[model samples]
Every structure is written in structure tokens, then in C-alpha cells.
Target: MKTEHRIRVLMVAAENGALPAAKVGGMGDVLRDLAPELAKAQVQADQIMPAYGRFHRHPHASQLARLTVPFGGRHEIVTLYQLANPAHPESRLFLLDHPLFSNAGDGVIYHCNDPEPYASDASKFALFCAAVAVALCQRHLSRPEVLHLHDWHAALLTVLRAFDPRYQPLQALRCVYSIHNLAHQGTRPFRNSHSSFGRWFPELAASLTDAQTRRIEDPSYPQCLNPMRAAINLADKVHLVSPSYASEVLQPSDHRHGIWGGEGLEQDLNRRHQQGGLCGILNGLVYPDTPAPPQSFEALLNAMHTTLLGWQGHGTHLRNVDFIAHTRLQLWQQAKRPPPSMLLTTVARLTEQKVAILCHRLDNGDTVLETLLRRFKQRQPQGLYVCLGSGNHTIEAELQRVAAHHDNFLFLNGYQEQLSAQLYRQGQLFMMPSSFEPCGISQLMAMREGQPCLVHAVGGLRDTVVDNQTGYWFEGDSLEQQGLALLARFDELLEAFGSDDWQRVAANAKEQRFGWQSPCRLYRHSLYLE
Candidate 1:
């Protein structure tokens, strides 16, 4: 009897949540969940990422191979290590380690280079891509039918496959590039710098044809190379995270109108779409058979208080945000009445994309958030608004200022997984007014917990949320209009809270299901098999 063969796929990404302490954001979550689901469909999935100077230290990790890779005009030795994935024992997770992988610092997966963005990170990923290419050429890891790359961090492998003669064998494999975020394109000088393409692969850079250069060059800055654009152009398929986002990127972005589209690569993305090389598939979440029990309002407050104490740590002086959060938690605990009728919660990274609208100032010289707090206080004096996140110092300062002035507002300046989970379960409404979202996991998590959300109607939010049903969504043509629309929607939700209509919405939210089974089937047919 003949046995069937399982299709093999190798995923290269910057972050993988399957391994311990390897995640930073949604990309990590996707990498972690997608592998096991694909396995259920009889596809063998293998994963690789930079060790970030930590994974190799795992007790079960074993060194697989050591290779000398050609990078930045010299040979740099990198070691490949394999660790057993306890979560999915059938899958393989490989980590490539080198001193440069820890350029920012040991165990740091990302870095912010102030004067020049993506400088240090670009070099690190460039070396990593080169090492991955060499590993495949030397058969350190089994070749797969599909080579899956995630985000701009792993995009340089596509460039190496296209330009470098030594890595020409990689060209035979089908490449699928997933764009988690297009805002960061990883553009850098093509020549005359330590981190330049010419420095990394001198012969290949010098021999590139004008047409080949055009394919990889940054649309806005011709002198620079954009790995995102290169991947989009060279990969067999270009994938957007959500259906709505895929359509949005075909048009040029207009920031003046609060529109975030293709950032400057609309033409390139359009060509790919025309060629049938583009796809949009919504991300999925794992739904456990036994869902965790919902916490009571008082339990939520206690969790927040305990998490705040942990964040406060052994410092002699508590940070301003921590102090404010501590006081707010204490005040709520001391209250003798029932929990507030309205509990608003948000969990996100405080980047411009996530919180810019909340920080937008109205004509009356008050931030949208401040105005909302003041109005919410007027309607429900006992109401509370809690936000948990940390990013962008400027935004953090602005949020802290709002917390200081509003007695009913609590801003937890650090993230704790347990507390966030509680916030999702206990809150009456979840808020996510991102300027643009590529398929948000937070909204899905909140909805899974039966908490209705108030989100901006763009990207995945537009796809997942239903107005006046599962959740409330608002949209506008300008930033000010968007802010005002959010305020208007909040007022409407407040008026409808606790009504029979609102309860139905909550019930519908809980009934909505977004699992990995269907998405994995799409991956098998559309992304991997096709």
C-alpha cells in the first residue's frame, strides 16, 4: 500500500510565540497558533526565527549546525539550534543565533534607533536573512514546498533569493509574504553605508539590472531599498491580514483625510492584485473547550490593584501613573455601593496608530479622551474608564495627564496578561479607536468574553464588528470628525446601556466565533497548496 505525502512548509518570521518569552505583538501570536492548526490538515509546518540571545539557553535546546554566512562583505558564523515545542510536539522550531542578533541587547527582539529608525534592527534582520539563505543552501534544514515569510523583518530573504547567485536554489521554492503591518517598510540606503545592500551583498548589488533595481527600490525614495516592496514584487503571493485591509491598500493613502491605505506602495500592490498574487484572509484565535469563568467587578479591581503593586516594584518612589492607578483602585475598593453601571476597558500598545484619536484635541482645547471622561462623569458619576498599555513616551505622558485630572479614569501604564484578561471579561464595553487596525486580536478577545466593543470602522474592525449589533463602530473623513464621531457613538452606547437591546448585543458577541479551522483550510488551498 502507498502512503499519502504531507505538504511541508517552512515559516520564517521575526517573532514566534510558540517558544518561551519570544513574543512581542500580534505577529508572535499568529506564528504560534497557525502552525498547530495547519498540522491538523495534514501539512507539516516548521518554524524559524532569531534566538535573540535567549532561546538557545533553553534546557532542551540542542545545537543543530554551525554555518559561516557571507554578510556585510565578510563571513559571519551563525549557529542553528532546535528546541522541542511542548505545545506542538510534531512541529519543529529552529533558532539562529549570532552576537549581532542581540545588537540592541541580549533577549531584545526589537529596538528603536532614535536618529535613524530601523537602523540597528535592519542590520540585524539583514544578517538573519542571509544566514537563513545559507542554511537552506547547505541543507541544514529540510527544504519545503513553500517558504513563508512574515512582515518586513524576514523580507530580505526574498531579495537574497532573487539577486544572490549563491542563494539561487531558494528561487525554486514558492514564496508567500504576509504583511502584518505596512507602515514600517524597512527602507535603507542601497550603498555607501555599513547597513547598505551593497555592503551586505556587494557582487549582487553591483550586478543588478535597472529593471531589477526598480522592482526593489522604495517608491518614495529611489536611492533606498524597501524590503517590503521587494517581497511584494518577488514573492509568489502577497497576503494582507484582513479582506477590508487588502482592498484598502490598493488606493494611495491620504493622511489629511485620516485614510491609511498602502503607504506609498499602492502601485506595486495594485500590480500584484491585478496579477492574482494578492489575498486577504482574516486572522484566527484559539477557543478553548472550557472557557475561563468571568470575574466579578470587585475581583477585576483587586486584580488591577495587585498588578499595579507588581509594576510599582521595589522603587522608593512610585511613578506618577502607578500612583494614580493605585489611588483609583483603592477608591473603588473603598466604595460601599454596587459596582459602577459602566465599566469601559482598553488594552493596546500606545502607538500613534492606536491612541492618536484619543489624544486629538477638540476646538474647545480638550483632548477627546478628556472630554469623554468629563461627559461620562456627568452621565454616570460612578462610571470608570480603564486603559492598560505602554508605548510611545509622548503618548504615555499625555495619557498620564488625563488620568491625573480625571478622578474616574485609571491609566495602568504597564501590561499584565492576567489583568488584561480580567478587563476583557468584566468590562461592560471595550474601546479600540485605532486610526487603522489590520485585524485586531484585542477586539476578538473582548467579544469572545461577551463584552461589546466601540471601535473605529476600518480594516478588520469593519469586518468583525456590526453596528448596533455585536459591537458599535464609527467612521469619519477627517481626524477631528473621527474624534467627534467617537464621542457621538459613546453617547449613544451610554444611553442604550443595560437596556434589553444592549443585552442582546452582548449575547450576539459571545455567539460570534472566529476559529483557526476555516482559516487553516484557506491557508492550505490558497497560500500553501496553490
Candidate 2:
């Protein structure tokens, strides 16, 4: 009898957000943690990402191989580099290099010249996914038994595999596509100059002839090529990052109140789910093995001071925690408010999902946060709030305005990993009031650091946190009601901080199993190895 080969996986990630990443976000964190866990389970997990130009300037990636691949009816040589993954020896990361993807500039990964009828982003990602397919199909370096892809960026793998004869070997490879967020469906018209994807991926075009779009699409609408739709139609397995979101996305679009239910791919998702092709896997946390003992307020301040001194040694005397502690002193030379006792931290994107409809235009007026601060001050006047991370420039400006006026609020507009870590370790609470979180990492990070999270029960938050057991949650029917509920929970926690019951909850959260062990075991047994 012939012996079966070892299970190997190739995870194609557009933004694998590992350590050298400018700023680590949720997806990057997940892939970083997960690759190793799968590897530990004896599955070789190799991740491939675009060797973005921003990182190219730095000598981080070492060139591994160079090969020519066909693109835009011609061919170009693409270089492959191996990125270091210190956590997993068996696991590897290959970075695809090409001028269009590399020279696209810093911080921005996806470039779109147009929004309708397909943006130039179409060409960029097509090149990326197509190049990845060709490189791996030819090299067979990893000898992948499974081809795994994340988001719409890598969905083109299915299209490439379906069309190109060079990708015949990939047809025999089991394909798994994971959707971290369903809001972004790469919908573009069939024809475009930059991509000309139909010409390149003719097999997919051939399938569209038999595509029963009217059956799945709205009768009033014409067929527009949706890449996510293509992936769902073509991939062997499809999964959401969280179970609640899996069920939510499977609901009829009309029933999907205010949430993005696969962004017009609901019908397809439902069909796929019924056919047993869809699932939800709660993303696990990358918690440090070392437990953080309960700390004191002085220790928090000392850490800030130490970090500040390190900055001073480098010849700069900027402010951080100290500024919030003495916001009035900067403006008036005297402390207006006795150092606000409570320290609350929120590190997230200032997007609609996070701010929940509170994200607004700055030109319109003061943001919802200004109003929230006004109301919060009326009852709980003494507290220090630190808002970190920036997105939606309007929200960033509004937050700056609030921080400028109030002695209690400090808005740090950037990604500073060290500062975020110190704050999470020291803060009394971490806040994540996302409207629809697939699976939140900040809350898990906060809980692991011994800071209890006060979150709205949704997506991963619902799965990970037990109300009043692991952390506090606020649930309501409407946004306004949810806001009220959040305040109520915050007030309860604030009033009872440093008490025995509060300590018990914090301890319980600390003891919670947020790590990758269980989740990886499931993948090994139920998905990958099986």
C-alpha cells in the first residue's frame, strides 16, 4: 500500500501583517499566530505576501528565487523572497516581487484608480494572485496539498486555477478560502484595460456563459463580475472568521438589518452553506505564555516614565501618558482636574463598524465622541481616556478637537506597538464597542494582559467573553440603546473597580483559553488533515 503524503498548506495573504509589518492589525495577527499552530500540528503552513515596496527599502526580505511568469498577454520576471518567521521553523513566508506591487508606495497596499466598473486595483490583485499561482505551480517548493487564500485579494487564485492549463496541478489541490470581513466584495464590470481579466482568465468567462446570474442576482440588475462571488462559486471550502457572522451572512439580504451580509453575495452564501461548503472558525488569540501578575497604578506610571526616558535618551522630549495625566498643566500652567483616576484605553480603527454610525464628517460638525464626552462628564467627571490608532481622517480630526479641549482625553493618532502594549498591561479597562466584529483581537489581548474588556456582544466578542464572568457586555436593539447600555456597564465597572468581585472577573478573564491550541486542533482534525 502507498503511504499518504504529509499535509502541506500554502496560505496566500495580501496583507499577512506579521512582525515587520508597519502596524499589525487583526488579520496579520491571526496569520502570524495561526501558521505556527498549524505547523506544530505537523501541517507545513507557508504564507505568501506581496513584497511591498515600502518594506523593500529595508533589507528585511532575503531573495530566494527568480522566475518569469506570463502577465497582461506578456511575461515578466518576478522574484521570490523568504520572510523570517521566528516562531515557526517548519512554517515559511514567500514574498512575491513585481514593480507594480512593490512601487505602489508605503502604507497603502491596494491601489484603485477607479471605484466603478473595476478599479486599477483589479489589475494589481490579478497580477498578484496570478503571479502567486504561476510561481507555486512551477516551483512546487512547498509541495502544498492544500491552497489556502484570504479575502478577495487572493480569490483570483480560483479563477487562475480554473482557466490556465499551467494551473492544472492546482486543480487537484484542495482550495480553502477564508473571509475575514464580508463588507468588501470586489465587484467590477467584465471589461477593463488594466486587468483584461476575462481575456486572461477565459475559462472563468466560459463558465459565466452558463452562470445563471438572473437566478442568483436581482432581476432588475445586470451581471457585474464579482470576484468574491467567483471565489464562493469556485472554491472547495468557504469559511467566515466567526460563527455569528457565518449565520448572519447566510441570512437573506433583506433580513440583514444594517449589516453587510456578504455584500450582495448572500444568495450564493446561503446556497454554499446548504451544500456544506460554508463554516465559521472563531479566530484564536496569540497570547503570551507568561502570565502578567496584578499590577499597581505606580507601575503603570513608571512604565510610561521609563518609556519617556528612553525617548529622551534618543534626544526627544515628547509627551504621552504624562500629557493625559496633566493635560490642564500644558494649557494653563496648573492642574485643573486632580489627575483623573480611571485609565481607559481604546485601540482600533475609527471606522463605522468600530464607531458604529458615530463616525461622521468633520465639516458637518463635532463628532459623536464630542457629544459622548459631554454626556460622560455630567455623571462621571473624573477619568482619563486614551484613544489610539487612526482612520477616517474626519474622525481623527474630531478626536483631536476633543483632546484639545478636555484635560481628560488623549488621542494618539498613529500605530505605536510599544505604547499600546504598556497601556493594555496597565489600563483599568479596554473598550471595543464594534457594531459588527467578526472576531476582535484587542479584547483578547486586553484580557490576556489582565485588563478586563467592556465590549458590545457581537461576533467574536460574543464567543470569547462571558458577560460579567470574563468581562462586561452591553446589548440593545438600537445604536442609541446600545450606547446607553454601554454607559450603564461602564458605570457599573467604574464604580466597582479594585473590588473582590471585579478581581474575580479579571482573574476569570485571565484564565480564559484564548490561545491557538483548541482552534488549531479543530483545523487539524476537522478541516486540514481530514
* Overall lDDT per candidate, in order of appearance: 0.89, 0.69
- lDDT accuracy of residue 227 in candidate 1: 96
Per the 3 Å backbone cut-off, how many clashing residue pairs does candidate 1 have?
0
Q: Candidate 1: list runs displaced more than 4 Å.
A: 1-5, 313-317, 334-338
lDDT of 1 by residue, 291-384 (tens): 8975678788788888988876857888988988888787777875578868999999888889889999989999999999988999889898
Worst lDDT run of 10 residues, candidate 1, spans 111-120
For residue 77, give model 1's deviation from the true position in Å: 1.4
Best by TM-score: 1
Candidate 2, pairs of clashing residues: none
Residue 234, candidate 2: Cα error in Å is: 1.3
TM-score of each: 0.96, 0.84
Candidate 2 lDDT by residue in tens digits, 280-303: 888987766666575655554445
Report the C-alpha displacement of residue 202, candidate 1, in angstroms: 2.8
